[model samples]
Target: MIAAKNVSLQYPDGTVALKNINLSVKPGELVYITGPSGSGKTSLLKLLMAMEFPTTGTLEIMGRSYGKGQTGPIRQLRRMLGPVFQDFKLIKGRTALENIMLGMRFLDIPASEMKKNATEALARVGLKKKANTPVENLSWGECQRISIARVLARKPLLILADEPTGNLDRENALNILELLVGCKDEQTAVLITTHATHLIPANQNRIIRLKEGVMEEAEA
Candidate 1:
C-alpha cells in the first residue's frame, strides 16, 4: 500500500538523512525498519506520512502521488493512515477518549459510533478503564497505549509507528507488538521502526535495515 522509489531527503543545513531509498509494503503485511539513531528510519516514516517531502524521487501511497497536485488527495490518503509518533503527541488537556475521537472528527462519523469505536480501541489496548482519564494523569506506559488506541480507533489501513516500544517494559512492549501484528489481517499494513532487536516478532519474515541513510534487506 506504500512505495518509495529512489527517495532522497536533504535538510536545509545540507544533511543527507536519506539516500536513494526504495521500499514497498503490501496490504496486510507487517514490516520492521530497524536501525541505530540517525539512520534515517524516522526520516523515512516522516516522508510516508507526508510530514516531510522527499528532495528527490517519488512517493506513492495507495497509488496516489504524494508530491503532486492538490492536497485533497494527500489528505484523503492520510485518512486511511494511522501514525503513532515517537513522542506520543497526545493533547495534554484532553481525555483519552477525546484524543481518540479526534481521529474520526474529519470523517463525519456519528457521535455514538465515534464513542463506540474509541471505547473498543481503548479496550483493545487494555485501557478501557482509563478512557475518561486525562492524558496528564496517565503513566508513561498508559499514555503510550492510549496513543496507540487513538490511532487504532481510526481503523487505519496503514500504521506507521516510530519506536513504538521505546519507553515500555518488556512485557508491555511485547503486548504492544502483539496488538500491532494482530491488526494486520487482510486489510491493514504495519511498518514499525525500532531499536530493540529482541522485540522483533519471530514469525515475521519482513524486516528492512537502514544504515547511515542507506537501505537494505535484513537477514533473518
Candidate 2:
C-alpha cells in the first residue's frame, strides 16, 4: 500500500536523515523497522505519516502522493492511518472511552456507532473495566492500551506504530508487539519501528534494518 522510490529526507541544516530509501509495503503485511539511535527510522515514519515531505524523490501512501506542502491533503490522508505514537497522545482529562471516540469524531460516523466501537476496542485491549476511568488516573501501560484502543476503534487502512514498546518489562513489550502485529489482516498493513529487536519474533521476514540513513532487509 506504500511505495517509496529513491526517497531522501534532508533537514533545513542540510543533514541527511534518510538516503535513497526504497520501500514497498503491501496489504496484510507486518513490517518491522529496526535501527539504533538517529538511524532515520523515525524519518521514514514521518514521510509515511506526511509529517514531513521528502527533500528528494517521491512517496505514495495508500494511493495518495505526498507532494511538498500539501497540508490540507496530508491532514485528510492521516484519516486512513491508525497510528500508535510513542507518547501515547491521549487526552488527559478525558476517559479512555472518550479519548477513543474523539479520534473518530471527524470521520462523519454516527455517534452511537463511534461509542460502540470505542467500548469494543477497550474490551479488546483488556481494558473494559477502565472505560470510564480518566486517562490521567491510568497507569503507563494502561494509557498505552488506551492509545491503542483509539486506533483499534477507527480500523484504518494502515497501522503505523512508532516505538510502541519503548519502556517496559520484556513481557509488556512482547504483549504490545503481539497486539500490533496481530492487528494485521487482508486489508490493513502494520509497520512498526522499534529498537528492541529481540522482541520481534525470529520467524518474521519483512524486517528492514537501517544504519547511517540507509536501509536493507536483514536475515530472518
Candidate 3:
C-alpha cells in the first residue's frame, strides 16, 4: 500500500523532478507508470523507495512516513519492499541461484528456506535451467528475469520495479510484464514503471501517466 499526497521532489540544484504528485496504490493492485525520458517516472519511484525524500507534501509507504535523512527508518522500511532495479545488479561470477539467495541474506529466513525460495523463484521465472549458470554468462533478458527472481524470492509486501522490460523484445517484454503482474496478491501490490505503453494489456489495472513532472490518471 502506498499513498502520496501532493508530493514534490526538488534536488539541491533547484531541479524539480516531480510536482504535486498524488497517487494511491492498494494491495493486489498492479499499476503501470508510463512516461517519456526525464518525465519524472523514475524520480517518483525513488521517492517511494525512500532513496529521496519529498521536498514538499507527504508520502506513506506501508503505513510508514519518510522524512529527510531518516536513515534508520529508511533502512527498516526498505526491508519490507521488493525492488527490481533497471540494472540487473546481479553479482558477477555468482550463479543465478546464488544471486537470488544473496538478496535475502539479511532477512530472518533460515538458510534452507532461503535456498528453497530462491530456487522456486528462479523456476517461476522460467529460468530453472540457469540456476547454476553464472549471471555474467546469461543474456540480457535472462539477467532481467533473474533480477525479478531476486525480488520475488524476498516475498516483500510491496514490489517496486523500475523498467523491468526496458531491453527486451516484444515477446520477452510481454512475458516479463506477465510475470510481474502475476506476483500480486491480497497481501501484495506491484508497481512498475515502463515507457512502452503498447505492451500493456487491456485490464482494469491503474495506469498513471507522467508528463513534465506532472501526474495524471490515464484515460480508460
Candidate 4:
C-alpha cells in the first residue's frame, strides 16, 4: 500500500514537477495514472521509487516513510517493488530466461527456485517457448513482455509500470495492459503511468489525471 499527503516535488532548477499530490493505494487495487508529456505522472512514480525526494509533505510506501536519511531502508524497500521501466532494460545478448534470472540473482532465492520462478513468469507472459531466444532477436512487444516477466519473477508486493504500452500498436497495447492487470491479486497492488488515455479500458475506475504538476481523480 502507498499513502501520500500533500506531496510536492521541485527540482533544483526551480521547476515544480508535482504539486500537493495526495494519494492512497491499497492492496489488490490497480490504479492508472494518466497524463501528457511533461506532466507529473513520472515525477510521482519517481517519488514512489525513491529516485527523488519530495520537496514538501509526506509519503509512506508500505508503512515506510521515504525521504532524507532513509537510504538503507529505501534500498530494502525497493526489493519489494517491481518496476517496469519505459526502456525494456534487457541485456541484448542474453536469452529471455537469462534476463529474468539475472534480475533474481540479487535476491536470497536459491538457484533452482530462481529458475523455477523465471520459467513460471515467462509462462505467465505467454513467452515460454521464446525463453531460450536472445532478447535482441525478440520482437518489440516480446521484449516488453520479457521485461514484465523479469519483474513478475521477483514476486513483488507492488508493481509500478511506467509507460509499458508506449511503443506498441493499439491491440498490443491493450494486451499488455491486460497482462499487467492480471498480475494484481490480494497481495499485490499495481500502479501504471501512461499518457494514452484512450487505450485504458472502460471498466477501470481507479484513474488519476495529472496536468501542469497538478493531480485530480478521474470522474467515475
Q: Best lDDT goes to which candidate?
A: 4
Candidate 4 residues 1-220, lDDT tens each?
A: 8999999999999999999998999899999999898998888888989999989999999997877777888888888899898888999889999999998898888988999999999999999999999999999999999999999999899999999999899999998999999999999999999999999989896999999899966544
What does candidate 2 score on TM? Answer: 0.96
Cα deviation at 190, candidate 4, in Å, is 0.3
Quote each prediction's TM-score: 0.95, 0.96, 0.97, 0.95
If the candidates were sorted by their TM-score against the true structure, best first, what order would they fall in?
3, 2, 4, 1
106-151: candidate 1 lDDT, tens digit per residue: 9767878999999999999999999889999998888888889988
**Number of backbone-clashing residue pairs for each candidate, in the order shown:** 0, 0, 0, 0
Off by over 4 Å in 4: 218-220
Error of 3 at 7 (Å): 0.4
Regions of model 1 farther than 4 Å from truth:
68-70, 218-220
Q: What is model 2's C-alpha RMSD?
A: 1.3
User: Higher TM-score: candidate 2 or 4?
Assistant: 2
Full-model lDDT, candidate 1: 0.88
Model 3: C-alpha RMSD to truth? 1.2
List the candidate 3 regions with Cα displacement exceeding 4 Å.
Answer: 218-220
Q: Is candidate 1 or candidate 2 better by TM-score?
A: 2
Per-model C-alpha RMSD = 1.6, 1.3, 1.2, 1.3
